[model samples]
Target: MHAHTATRPVALVTGAGRTSNIAAATARTLAAHGWDVAFTYYRPYDARMPWGAEEGAARALHAAITEYGARALGVEADLADPQAPARLMDTVADRLGPATALVLAHCESVDSGLLDTTPESFDRHFAVNTRAAWLLIREYALRLKAPHGAGRIIALTSDHTAHNLPYGASKGALDRITLAAATELAHLGVSANALNPGPVDTGWMSAEHARQLRSATPLGRLGTPQDCAHLIEFLCSARGGWVNGQLITSNGGLA
Candidate 1:
C-alpha cells in the first residue's frame, strides 16, 4: 500500500481547506521534504467560517505542493460525510500511493456559547471536529503498510473555551480518540498524538487578540501555520518515532 510506483511515501492531510490553513502548511512542508501529499478540503465549512470562502484553494495548494517536485493530489471532500475518509484513502492510493502520515487539522466551530448553541450546531461541530477525525484515524491505521513504526498520525486541537463551547468539547473528544490510536495501532507500527496550537492567527484572531496572546506568551509572538507544520514534520520523522499517545502543547510557552 505504499506509493503506487514505489516513489516517496505519501501523506494524507485533512483540513487543508484553504491556501493559508495549517494543513496547507504541513502539506507544503512534507512535499518539500520529499513526501508526496494528498489533501482534503471542505469548502462549504471554510466558507462559513470567519476566514471566508476560498475559490480553488485545493487546486492552488496542489500546485504549490507539486512545485516542490513531489506528486500531489487534492480532493474536495467533506470529512463530516463519514464516508469521505475511505474515499480519500482510496483516491490517494490510486493516485499518489499509501499515506505514510495523516494530519488532522480541520475543525468546525462558531462562537456560540452553551446557552446560544443549538442542537444542530453542536451536532454539526462534533460531526466534523470529532466523529470525522475518529473515523479518519481508524481508516488510516487499517490501511497502513507493514513495519510497525512507519505510520504517523497527528490530530490538531485547541484549548480555548468559554463562548467556543462546541469547539472546545468536540476537540477534547478528538484529542482522546486520537491518543488511543497510539496503543490501538501500536502493534501495527503506527504512532498517534495530538497537538494544541493555541491562538493561531488564521484570520479569526482580531488585532487585539493577537496583542493579548503575544503579551502573554513568553516568546511574544503569535503561533503561525509554519509553527504547526514544523512540529508535525518532526512527529512524522524517524526521531519522533518514540513519541506517542501524549497531547503535546506547542504554543511557544503560552503562559
Candidate 2:
C-alpha cells in the first residue's frame, strides 16, 4: 500500500489475480485514470482451472498499478466463503479507504451442463457468483463515503447458459441483484449496471476457437482485456452515472 491520496477515489476490483485478465486491466486503467485500486483473487480457484494460476501474479499486478502513481492492494480472498465479502471490505478500508467503486469481475466457471453439472458445482457457483456478489454489494453500500452520483457498481455478466449451466445461471442471478442495487441505493447516488463482454480470449480460447470466433464477429477481431477495462473506467466516471439499472453488452457485434 502507498500513501493515501484524498484527491483520488478508491476502487475495489475482484478477480484480479492474474496480470492477463480483465480485472487486472481494469485496475491498471483505473489507476491511470486517477483512482487507487484494491483487487481480490483466489489462487485455489485459478489453480483448478484449465489455465493454472500464474505464480506471483498478485505481486506483479500490485507493482503494475503503482507504476501509474496509484495505491494498490492485492488481497487473496475466496469469495466462496460467505464471510469473505465483509472481511474484504474491512481490509480495503484499513489499507486504502472506503471504496467508491465496486467492480465484480470474479466468477466460478467449470463448463459443466445439464446432467454433468453436479450439485456441489452448482452450489459453489451460486455461492461465489450470486451470493458473494450480493454480500459484496451489501458491504460496499454499508461502508461507502462517496458524494452524490459518485458511487458506482459494475458486475460482469453473461447470457450463455446452454452448455455452461451453473455459471450462466449464477451470473443471471447476479445481474438481478446488481440491478436491484441501482434502485435500492438511489438515495446514496449509487448506480449499478451489468456488462457482458463477449468472448474475451484471456487464455480461455484455443487457437482454432479464437479464429472461429473472430471470423464470426463483424469487427474481425477478438475482445481484449483493455477493451472491457475502458468501459469499466467510463462507468466509474461522472459521465456514466445515468446508465443505471441496465445490462450493457460490449461484444464487437458478434454473430
Candidate 3:
C-alpha cells in the first residue's frame, strides 16, 4: 500500500490474479501509463478450469503492477456474490481513490453445450459473467467524482455458444448490459465497450488447438493478453474517448 497522494488516476480490474492472464496484462499496462491499480479474483473458480489455478496469482500481479512504481492492491473475491462488486469498489476507493476505469476479465468457463447446460451451471455463469458485470459498471459510474467522459468500463467477451453454452450466453448478456451502461452513462463521462478477443492462449489451449487457432487467424497466430491490453490502453486514453457503446473486435481476423 503506497498511500498515494495527489489523486493519482486509478483503474479497478477484476480477474487479474494470474500473471499469464489478460487482467494482469491490462493492470500492468495501466500501471505503466501512470495509473494505480486494484484487482479482484477468486481462486476457487480458476481451480475448476482445465488450467488449474495459480497459487498466488494475486501476489504476483500485485508485484508486477507495483514494479511500475504504481500503487497496487489485489483482493480475492468471488464476483458471483451480489455484494462482492460493491465491496470491491469500496475497497478500491479506500485503498486507491476513485477509479477512472474498470476492466472486467473474469469469466466462468465450463465446457458444456446445449445438453451440458444445467440449472446450476447456467446460474453460476450468469452470476459471474452477467450479473457481476452489471453491478460493476453501475457501481463504477455511481462512485466516480470525475466529470462526464472520464469513466471507462470495458468487459472481455467471446462468442463460443456452440461448444460452451453457458459461458457464451452469459458473455452475450454482458455485451448488452455493458452497452446499455454506455448509453445511460454517456452523460456522466463514462464510455463502455466490449472487446471480443477470439481464442487467446492463456495456458488454456492445447498444442494442437493452438496450432489450429493460429491457422484460423490470418495473422497466423493466436491473440496475446498484451494484445488485448493494448486496446484497453487506447480505450482508456483521450484519443479513444469517442468510441462508446460499441463492441469492438480485437481478433486478428479469427472470426
Q: What's the CA RMSD for each of the models?
A: 2.4, 2.4, 2.6
TM-score to true structure, per model: 0.95, 0.97, 0.95
Prediction 3 TM-score vs. true: 0.95
Q: What is the C-alpha lDDT profile of model 3 across 132-165, one tens digit per residue?
A: 9999888888898765667789999998899899
Sort the predicted structures by lDDT, highest score first.
2, 3, 1
Model number with the top lDDT: 2
- The C-alpha lDDT values of all candidates are 0.86, 0.94, 0.87
The local distance difference test score of model 2 is 0.94
| Ten contiguous residues with the weakest lDDT in model 3 | 1-10
Which segments of candidate 1 are over 4 A away from where they belong? 1-6
**Clash count per candidate:** 1, 0, 3
- Candidate 1's TM-score reads 0.95
lDDT of 2 by residue, 38-151 (tens): 999999998998899999999999998999999999999999999999999999999999999999999999998898999999999999999999999999999999887899
Per-residue lDDT of candidate 1, residues 1-255 (tens digit): 233224678789888887887899999998887788998887788777777778878788989999988899888888778898888888888887678899998888788897999999899889999999988887777777735687899999988768989999999999999998888887888889999988787777888888999999998899899999989988887778889999999898999
